[model samples]
Target: MNLQSILSQHIIKAVSESYAATLENIEFQATRKDFEGDITVVVFSMLRTVKGNPVQIGETIGEYLVANVAEVSKYNVVKGFLNLVLSDAYYLDFFTSIQNFNSYGKVPATTEAIMVEYASPNTNKPLHLGHVRNVLLGYSVAEILKAAGKKVYKTQIINDRGIHICKSMLAWKRYGNEETPQTSGLKGDKLVGNYYVKFDKEYKKEINTLVENGFTEKDAKAKAPILLEAQKMLQKWEAGDPDVVALWKKMNGWVYEGFDATYENIGVDFDKNYYESDTYLLGKDFIQSGLEKGVFEKDADGSVWCDLTDEGLDRKIVLRSDGTAVYMTQDIGTAIQRVKDFPDINGMIYTVGNEQDYHFKVLFLILKKLGFSWAENLYHLSYGMVDLPSGKMKSREGTVVDADDLISDMAATAKEISEELGKIDDFSAEEKTQLYKTIGLGALKYYILKVDPKKRILFNPEESVDFQGNTGPFIQYTYARIQSILRKAASASGYTESVEIRNLTLEPKEKELLKILQQFPDVIQLAAGNYSPALVANYTYDLVKEFNSFYQNVPIFGAENPAEISFRISLCDAVGSVINTAFSLLGIQVPDKM
Candidate 1:
């Protein structure tokens, strides 16, 4: 029932009646700024059905539309484009029709459900800048899907059991004099992460000592006492040694608490969590079944493989010769287990780095070959790495930008910028602190999300907190401005309700704002289909820019006509509501005052 659909129906009728030709569809685009029209129809596309010059065909259709459609007040044809000028009544009716702009664009949840996996981090180190991008992208996509009427479940798979985890446990037990997170006054993950780094340092020392005694570099590394002990610890843990298992549970418990704090700080949560210890061996049964069904092949060494050469991928190992499951095996089992847990989910999206693109491709192909219907709906939201202005991060060396530290730094940066701007001079201490966090986090989320997921990001904290240009603070400031206008309007009389306006003229800026506002629902649908938060982020920036232009050029309070002032106030309110809702989809908060 939108304008495009209405025009398309009428244009089809016009083509059949005038040219005696059947037009299957109509192509529409935004009217060029130079042209005085609301929407344009490409007559060039219609030439296949209507035999005539493009301009002539456009004119014929324009005439038919102006004559038949009430909304089409006037029209002009330039080259092959039929630009239709809609009546002011149409835009007015649109503005009046939306009762609540806050929830205006969101659709009610549908029966279709999807599981989005993100922030699946290893237990060895604290989450860093890369994980920040993953969580933000995943969280935003989930929100966008929900807005598009899909039931969504957010989840993560913790890498809790591995040789890397053993390294940390070995280091902590050997180096520390009974130090704990409580005693050390450090986060549990950071404490464990320190031991992980310590292990590497000690292991290198042992390797050097062995090399000095005439051993080869490779042999020295392989024979390092620290590494050998760590490997032995892994074997013991696998054998369910009581002592090692208890230590793992205790350390991992502390690490989980630390992880919960970080996740809370970053404003993301998982509906369900899958642990590697629990799911690592789950795919062995599936591998045996697959071998029996000819979906997989068993090598002479007793290893299981999935031959994907015909599908343009090499053979992938499902189980080792020792009958132990590989990472791929665990992932397959985890995916299947998710479906069993959430029966309504027909699809899943894995938000992982682009480095694992091939892995996901192989995983999806194998699942499809195994005859799982839902496997066809699987998607890999592969994103590029997030680098800092300094350089890339290495987790083992402990040089990665910690998520907690980055968040704190963002807030600190916001404070510096806000103090310099002196905008929140009247804010109380608590209010100022809260505002700083909002602006800082908003800036961080927006700067990263504004770019396409496939592109690498060189994040700059100071740059993101800027109050001008296409930054989060800039948009937040505009939203706050609209709120100020609304407050002023509320204090004045006769602007309480936005009633229908009759016998009134519309401003060009007002019409432009209406046009953009009308595209919100469609934009949400587009963003949802593409699984891209960049679309939603950029759309919000465009809306904010348009609103700012309208604010400067149009008179909201000083207008002579009461109806005009009321309508303008209503327009401002609608824009603010949308800004709030759009920011919500990006997991960014817009302040009422900044």
Candidate 2:
């Protein structure tokens, strides 16, 4: 139903051949302004097996293709490439096609279920800039998949227990810290994080003093019993010791409350939340089950491990030698539990840092060993970390970018920009804040998503995100401008489609512009196929740049011919829809005014 399918079908049918799905790629090329085409098809790629001169083969195929195709007005074989030019008369039909289906270029009957797990954060602290990357990549992946007719399941896992959480609890308890979040005038996560840092400082000093004596640093650190006491606290809560459970529940509630605000602000959500605390025991059971099934082996001292050395991976510990759960154990248990919860699930995906590539590789291998047929469906959407200009962010050195503080800072900057532009003169105070939230969050999400997810990116606050040129705000403003023009055009009196565009006879600028505009569908399919939202990001900017050029060179409303005006308006509508949809897939909201 989309442009590619229609065009591909025409090509295959003319060849007297059939495929389950046709393979066709449409792209823009630069071959000097004198070149007579917009989109170039590499006919050589298809004809290489035939063993002939690519130029003649392209010419023959291009002629045959034009004979079968009605949408394309003409074809030119240039330097062994067959470039097809779409007829201006068929432009309205294509626009009408997209408008009618409401799917735009999304292929029908190509339903795939995708699980996107993003924005997974630890409860010990609020989210940081690192989490923003995870959230953006995960959200964008889900949106891209959904746009391609896939049912996407978004989920998150909270690393809410273990030594990390214990550090905060210990600090809060020992520092005369009966102070609650509200009482201390601090956000929930920040209040808890203060104690986490404090514990590290205090614990390190205690270990240093012990080391200054006869004890080794390692021995002294282990002998201090702080982490042991933290473990005891965890055990007490698990045992339903009333006071310990009360504190644990209260503190975690505040953290969740803070996390909810952050998620809501950033337009990120998950269908399910998996807590390490709840699932660690499930992992233990899963490991024991794997052991009984002859998929795993027992270590000395009653520990459990999975040996993947045969697969060029090191052995992984599941449960500690003391039989307590490790992070890996909890992950294994959660995967199984998720499958059990949703037996109809076609797949599971983990959105985690690239640093954990080895961890997930081992996890999936163990799952496959346990005979889970869906192991092949498991995916690790590993994204690189966001580092600062100085280098990698480290918490102990206090270089970590706290999530709430950073968002607040960005929102304030957005507010300043909005005020400078007088963009919210008509809005209420609360509405103004909402606008700031939208702008700030959209800026952050788009900034993160525009880069290839696999590559490490420096989130330079100054240069990386600018108000003008290829930023989220630029696209939003373009959408708003088109909307304004359309509103004015619609309200204008006595307008009619009075002229015909039999020969496109376009200016060089218009041809260059149309070339990019026509590739929207192809871009969507590529983004979906690759599981990469950067494709969408790149496509949106390309379209915007084309539209900008078109806007400057061509007059829509004041054109001499009414038909030309109407045609231009229709073109604007199509371009606007594609821009909006593409940005939506990148988890960016377009504002009507900004």
List TM-scores for all candidates, in order. 0.97, 0.88
For model 1, the superposed segments whose C-alpha errors exceed 4 Å read 460-465
Tell me model 2's lDDT, rounded to 2 decimals.
0.75
lDDT of 1 by residue, 231-319 (tens): 99999999999999999998898899899999988888889998989998887778878888899998999998999899778999999
The number of the candidate with the highest TM-score is: 1
Tens digit of lDDT per residue, candidate 2, span 539-560? 8888898788889878888776
RMSD (Cα, Å) of model 1 = 1.6
TM-score of 2: 0.88
